[model samples]
Target: MSCSIKRTSSTSYRSGGGVCGGGSGRNSSVSCRQYASSVIGGGSYGGGACSIGYGGGMSAGSLAGGFGGGLGGGFGGGLGGGFGGGFAGGFGAGGDILLSGNEKVTMQNLNDRLAAYLDKVRRLEEENAQLEHHIREWYRKQAPSVSKDYTSYYQTIEQLQNQIISATVDNNRLLLDIDNSKMTADDFRMKYENELVIRQTVEADISGLRNLLDDLTRTRSSLESELESLKDELIALKRNHEEEMRQLQSQTGGDVSVEVNAAPGEDLTKTLNDLRNEYEQIIEKNRREVEQWYEVKIEEVNRQVTSSSQDIQTSSHQLTELRREMQNLEIELQAQLSTKNSLENSLAETESRYGCLLQQIQGQINSINSEEEWLASIRCEMESQNQEYKMLLGIKTRLEQEIAQYRALLQ
Candidate 1:
């Protein structure tokens, strides 16, 4: 039979067990205490006290005289020769207080256990040190990566910023140019209005001149009719005077009667001739003067009308050309505005594209970081399992060595 016990106390551990065998009946008891430290990889298990006890018992019997003859020793005594007399039994008890004593044996056992534990602890410490070293190296490798890769992006953003600034400047310049054009156009329009007003005034003056020419033409026609009537009356008066002279001669018959008058009535025929000639000269002079004045006025009015017509035509042509030029300028400005808008839209699209690219890069960096953390965790777990395996193997080795030592002592 075998029995065992285990317990914990204080900051130390003790554990031992013994196997007993005997040729006769026997029993033994043992007690042991130990302090130990356990570790797995880079971690520590901190505990202190333990107890272990074991005992065994066995039965044994001796032979009778008939069976003892084969042993070459004759029955030496009467009890020795009997079947039930050669019986023997033994009882043993031993106790080991593993860490409880200042005794050498206890000290040696504790020292051995402590040495084993210390060796295991040293191995674990070395592993932890290695782990820490590796972590430090990894951090060194990854530290620079913590800063985002923004150099290329920064360049692109800077370029975009520059482009935006340039575009703004250009836009302002374009606006200024447009304002200038507009002002110039307004000035031209004002000039056109002033020219139009001048043209209307000139046309009004021409109309007044034409009315005066018409009035002069009518007065000349009235003077010609009055002159014709005066000529007819003078002719009628001469014919009447000739008729009266013929009548007086006929009444006097063929008789020659001489009558003296006061200066022969002043020569009636000569007087009539003089009156007609003088009237004709006056009419001719008046007609020539009126014709010359009418011609001069008509010529002056015609010259003015020709000049006014030419000026109006020139002004109209100038206005048409200005309008065409203004239209062309407006069209060109519209095209420029359209081009600017397109450029702005392209800039916006470029910004959006770059933003998306940056987002993707950031996400990739995050994934890489997470993967690194996962790899570190896996490495730690592997190291822990390896340490546990090493510890279990060490325990197995110690148990086997102890078994071999006991067997040798028994021999």
Candidate 2:
């Protein structure tokens, strides 16, 4: 019988040993094969046996050092002795002569080592199950909660923005209206000032006309006093002329006397009578002319005064109406200004309230994002643990198969 073993620094192991051929005796053949691939820290081992061969392989770290050499030396010595006996004997011999006491002892030791490895594998499996249960519990405890919906908050923000836009437009429009009203009030004020100037001018003219009328009245009174004095002088002159005529008639009562020649005696009484009549007509004509002139002047003054008074009254009425209208406009403008101020305050308050709400919503969103990130990290950790568990399970399965093959070989 001959056996061979191969090993590499990379932790790969391959073995083919215990090949034997015999004739005439009960022929027994054992073949064992092992393959392993390993990395620096961890690796996998696989082995199989046919007939009566025992094979084991291990790789990487403590597993390679602890079990690889032991199993190799034990099986090599034990199988080499057992196969050597089979090769020397004839095929017709019974199988009871195949092993010596040392071979039995080596086999017993291998069986004890296999049982210990199996127990270790069972304990490892239990630990893996516990690890899996812990992973499940962690997942249950650290899972993220469902996120809250913010669509309604977004809609409310949109509505508030629209309202703010509308309020701004209304505020601008109100400002324009106030400007227009101010311009209108200024125009009315200008008109009132112009009317006041005209009224003052009319009043001055009325005062001047009143002074002229007083002067005309005083002139008429002086003319009447002069006319009365002229009439009394005319009556006294007529009485004196009649007394002279009576004296002349008494003196010429008896003395009839003579022939008077000298241009047929001039008529002195006739001349006197003619002179009185001429003086009376002249006084009457002068009085009638003075009266007509005074009456005409009085009528003209009265007409002017009446026209001026009527104009003043009309101007006063118009000024009063303008004042009332201006007052109404001022009242309306004040009301509109008050409304504008209230709306501005309301808009400002709305903006402040919504701004705070937006800030709170943003904070909530950030918190949710942070939680999602944490959950993602946890999921990655769980996946890594699951992969490691699977690797350990594969190692356990391979170890069990090797143990089953060792038992078969022992039997």
Off by over 4 Å in 2: 1-145, 222-273, 362-411
Reference-based TM-score, model 2: 0.53
lDDT of 1: 0.51
Once all C-alphas are superposed, what RMSD does model 2 give against the true structure? 14.4
Task: Report RMSD (Å) for each prediction in the order shown.
Answer: 17.9, 14.4
Error of 2 at 222 (Å): 4.3
Query: 117-185, model 2: which lDDT tens digit per residue?
Result: 446546766886787788778767766355467899789878878988998898899899989999999
Worst 10 residues of 2 by lDDT: 86-95
Number of backbone collisions per candidate, in order? 13, 6
Question: Highest TM-score among the candidates is held by which one?
Answer: 2
Q: Pick out the ten consecutive residues of candidate 1 with the lowest summed lDDT.
A: 74-83
